[model samples]
Target: MGKHLESDGPSSFSRDTVKAIISQFLGFLLDAYDLTMILTIAPVLAVVLFPPSSSLLATFNVIFAYSLTIIFRPLGSAIFGHLGDKLGRRTDLIITVLGLGITSALTAALPTYAQVGILSYILFVIIRIGVGIFAGGEYAAGHPFAMEWTPYKWRGFISGLVQGGFSFGSMLTAAVLSLFISTFGVKGLETYAWRYLFLTTLIPAVIALAIRLSMKETPIFSDLKAQNKIRKSPFLDLFRKPYRRDFFQVMLFMTGLFFYSYSLFAFVPTILEHKPSVFSLSTANHIYTIGTVAAFFGAVLFGTLTQIVGRRRLALIWAVITFIVSIPMYYMLMYGASIGNVAIATIAVIIIGIIAQGPWGMIPIYLSERFKASMRSSGLGFGYSSGIFLGGWFSIYVPLMHEYLFKSIDTPTNVWFSTAVLLMIGAVIVGIGQYLGPETLGTRLSE
Candidate 1:
């Protein structure tokens, strides 16, 4: 802690730190926009690509594609994580941005099942896998790059800026989808509007790549590499010494975070699907748009809060609030609520955004501080990527569980009650986890 305090002295800020934060923020923005665009468009795409009777199947197909991506994310993270550590963060960042952009563009050109038969599905799966792999690399590099560049005193705020980009991207996606759908008839959207959605990824992807290209490797990683202090087996070494307990704690914390995140995100759209009266496609999308906007501000607010109060304290407070609010907020949305009611529900969603989503702002720093620079990339990559795997896949199963096993969607009340119960459980887990976690504010990168 004394070393951490020393590192927090006046010399911490630099022009390069600003560049790194902006570059990583842009990359996250693009990733978020692309991912959310796909999620928002899935329902509409189902109506377009599949037979009318197979709409549900189409929804499942999209989910399956997403599941494939989630499953492969860790592999991408591990592969690129090593590259980021051994080669350079800048190198990996550039490659991932270009790869993700190219894959997204290719997705725009893919034919429908009607046109290509089974080949369309195959192509979709392959494209998603490619995107998933690149996305895996993006986070592995992006977070560390931002953390390594910034001083400890402002790490939470800078990291929040990076995380905030995701919310902005989501907001941008919702706006894009809304505009496209409004302008193009649903039939027209099915034919060509979706293609434009894919094309939009190209702009941010190119920008992120360019920004990253101009940036150098983190001073921290560079210094470590210069000393030949790189770990021979970073994954193995992550648990070998002082890092073992911290590693496990971060892993558990991340797992709870992702579980609640995935569950909330997956369930929201599905629940919207079930409640046409309250959430027509347009209306539901509007809710998502508003929620994303809320998330953007929430991230900024929480990030700033972390700086003032410390990361661990902020996380614990927000997590408890999220847990208490989960059930009631969701129940309100489940019944035939008005748009205004849904808007109110956004308050809870915003809090979730702040707590579950906001802690990620500090994660890059938290993980980096937990390990030496030699193993930082591998530790952060493995921990965060593994959390995504567990949380991401389990979320897919939640919809399936509710739809097939519980038969909860049979009635409005059942749907509300079931989702509320699931959220309650997730909220409790996340809240407790945060309380027991370490506070890494002002931690030294070189420690």
Candidate 2:
């Protein structure tokens, strides 16, 4: 620590380090904000795209569209991850942010079913696909870029705080949605207010782009170029020998991370709204916002702990805690909602959010440290995004598994048990992955 401090100057966080962190945070925040806008208004969009009588199918369709974005992210990761490693982090990030900004603007202006029939839904799906590609590239480039700038001792703090942007962005969406609903009423949301939801991100997109423009190339990447060690194919390089093992292990851990995220943070609001006449939509949104708030802080706390306790130990502890508590934690959520105890349910959601999502705070640095600089950008981005291939589909699998297991979707019973099982499954994978992967707590970025 002292040696790194001496080399990096006395302070752990310099002005440039802070700027890099903030820039990447804002980029990630905007990414979440844009992607989540679809979910915030998914029910309404479903109605506009399909016949209201077929509410179930319409909802499923919108979800499929959303999932398409996840499934297609690897293409972006490969393409942008390659660019990032080959060209530089700053250039690749600028391209991604700009692509995202344009796609978001396109989504905001898309035609509705009333105007263009099936074409409307088709266009919306296409735009979401575009979003997935850009969003995939975003973390692939931005994560490594920012981590490369961080001082060794400060990695945990930077990782946790930067990753917290996802929750902050989701919460930001809830806040903006609430404001618009008040101003325009639910009627206004369906008519036109929803456009602003997508359009609103344009401002932040520009701001993030400006930040990327001002940023310098990461020192490690610059040095790689100076030494003529830039890999000819960064994405393909991950498949070679030693890095191949690191690639899959990180991918496994990340798959569990995505599963944990989708299971709790993504499913809660839907679960609350599905309960039998317990919470109003407004109350449910409030609960979601609170959970996200807790989740953001939880990530920072756990991430900070990872630095002290070691990543493998910290992750194993959480994995065990999650496994033992999954059933009870979910039961509390169901029990509180069923009994109309919003406080009980809200508290359950908060605890679940912290335990489940907090460990992600260590991801940026952990993944970066696992690979050398030559493959760092591609390895980090592709591995992180690759998890979506399996883990991302867990949300879809829960309902199917519930229907098969319970022999009844006749009620909300499926939610409590099925979700608990899936959450535990994901947590176990996390434990195994962390245990098997190398402990990287004290490693330098250039290691």
Candidate 3:
């Protein structure tokens, strides 16, 4: 505890702080919109962008588009993290939102396979990488920007409030896409509905960008600037002495979250859609939307609880719970014979969402508290984005593993079982990481 330990009323925070948090929340919505929409629309993209001549090529095109975005995120993280650390979080965020909005608009209007042949697929991927780069900068700047402005006492709750914005975005994307598909029908969705989905992302991006531009620099960053103590190269400094342990710990924490969340949210939907006999696309989307909405509230609840239970202990408890419940939950969801059985399965998934994503809501504060103001943005950015990029790749391999290892016993039940095993592994890893780290609930951010 230091000068920054003083408590302040919620209203004591300046308008700039409130505005910045709102902008960050909106930016998160846009980020989730693009990523989730890509996964949701993968089947459509495969049919429209790839030649219908071969099924293998179609799968490749869809997977390639999704994977490229995940792979390039870290590159964007490093680049934008440097700029954010040097210039300012606000300035870097402005550039990131603009890039996301413009690139998304362009991709929405991209040519179909019929018009441009292979060039259509090629251009889609190139622009997807661009979107990933822009998205890379968003959280790196936004999280630190929001967390740095809050008082120590309220950090846990506010961190959950801010990060919970991600679940809102996920729910919105799923709901809207489901509505669009229902209105347009499957044939129409493949034809033009997908284009409009990307186009809609521009609205939030522009609005969030405008609010960000109107906002002031974070109080922490401003104070550092006034003292002339800001690092000239904070990105490099993140890997040097003193800061390395904090960076690594946050990286491990985020890695477990990415593995757990991405596997359930990203991997499950795709698997369900591809196996239509087991679940329709719209049904899958509805399940995801419902699950994420529940998760959002879970995040808020768990985030608040961190203040009482301690961050490390809370994370460990949730990890173990998720690990134990995963297999039985999946078995119910996959093998149930009646609608009641399906309902139970869906409820099981929702429970997993609650515990799995709950700890994440506290991450912004935890990460922000770990670094000095000089390199906070860069360190958080690199650690968070790099963890996600690394953990996200497992989604790519999961499909292949399902195809090869379980080829003989290829059933929906087996697929769900495989998902459970991965979730269990994620829980074990997260629990161990939390055990290795210190309790950050009472730690004070450097002023």
Candidate 4:
């Protein structure tokens, strides 16, 4: 630890470091915006894809559309993780950004259910799967690239800021699309508004590309190449000795992260719009925007704090808080809505946002510090993404848990009971997983 320790010296704030951070932050912002835009857009798309009478199926179909993207992410992680480890993070990241932007832009040209029946829905599903793949690839390359460039002393802060881009992206998407839908109303949403909204997805791609073109490979990756330490068949190497154990442990931590994150994000809109009366899409979206703004701040705050408390310890604390508050905060949200009180709901969202999202800020550094520099990208990419196997199923699990809890769906309850249960499960997994793992705070990356 003493020999490998890094100093907060001049090289810590080098030009390439700044570029790496900027590229990842902006690139992930694009990832979250495009991927999550489908959630707001899905409602409008349901109109074009399903018959007027298909309500239950319409909602299920919409949820599944996004789920397909989430589930397919591992394949992309595997493919791109290998590329990042072998060819280099810079090249892998460049390819993935272009792919994500192109795939996102293609959604605007897709035909509707009325225009081509089920064929239209199939086409949309194909595009979303493409999105899932590239998103996974971006995750593989982006974090390692940035973290390797970061100084050890500020690793936690940089991790938080980079991962916080996801929160910022989510908030931005809600603000922009929510306002767009509010301006047009439901009918206009079903008309030209939806397509135009999707067309705007190209902007992030262009922005990220300009930034990446100017950036160089990290100092660490360059060192590895000079020594010829880059692993052949990097993805397969994960299953070999030394790396495999840490790889799977980080996978569990990531699973817990995704579970709580999806629970917080996927269903809140339904609660805001349908359950609580006197709330419409316009007002509900404001709540979403405000809540995510809180999340971005929460992430940065926790990231900074991890520099003090240590990553494993903070994760234990946050997971416990998330479990404890899960049911009560949601109850408050429902009660606030039932009584036509927006203030209580807003408070619930803010508290929940902070406690729920803080671990995400810590994880970027935690995972990056866990693996050796030689296998860092592959280990981080696949280990982090493999969690989706079990964790990403919340869209399906929510309904299943709702039925298990109530024996039927309850309008007032939504999936609150299930979400609470899900949070608890996530709490236990992350709490124990991270606790049993190494505490990587302030640890320097080593080849």
In order, the Cα lDDT scores of the candidates are 0.70, 0.80, 0.75, 0.80
Model 1: CA > 4 A from native? 3-12, 54-57, 239-244, 336-352, 404-417
- Candidate 1 structure, TM-score to reference: 0.90
Q: What is the TM-score of each candidate against the true structure?
A: 0.90, 0.94, 0.92, 0.95
Between prediction 2 and prediction 3, the one with superior lDDT is 2
Model 4: weakest 10-residue lDDT segment is 2-11
Best of the two (1, 3) by lDDT: 3
Candidate 4: tens digits of C-alpha lDDT, residues 304-345: 899889888888888878888888987777677667688988
TM-score of 3: 0.92
lDDT of 2 by residue, 70-115 (tens): 7878889989989888998989999999998889778878888888
lDDT of 2 at 41: 66
Root-mean-square deviation of each candidate, in angstroms?
2.7, 2.2, 2.7, 1.9
What range of 10 consecutive residues in model 2 has the weakest lDDT sum? 1-10
Per-residue lDDT, model 1, residue 308, is 74
Instruction: State the lDDT at 352 in candidate 2.
Output: 80
TM-score leader: 4
Q: Give residue 148's lDDT in candidate 3 (0 to 100).
A: 72
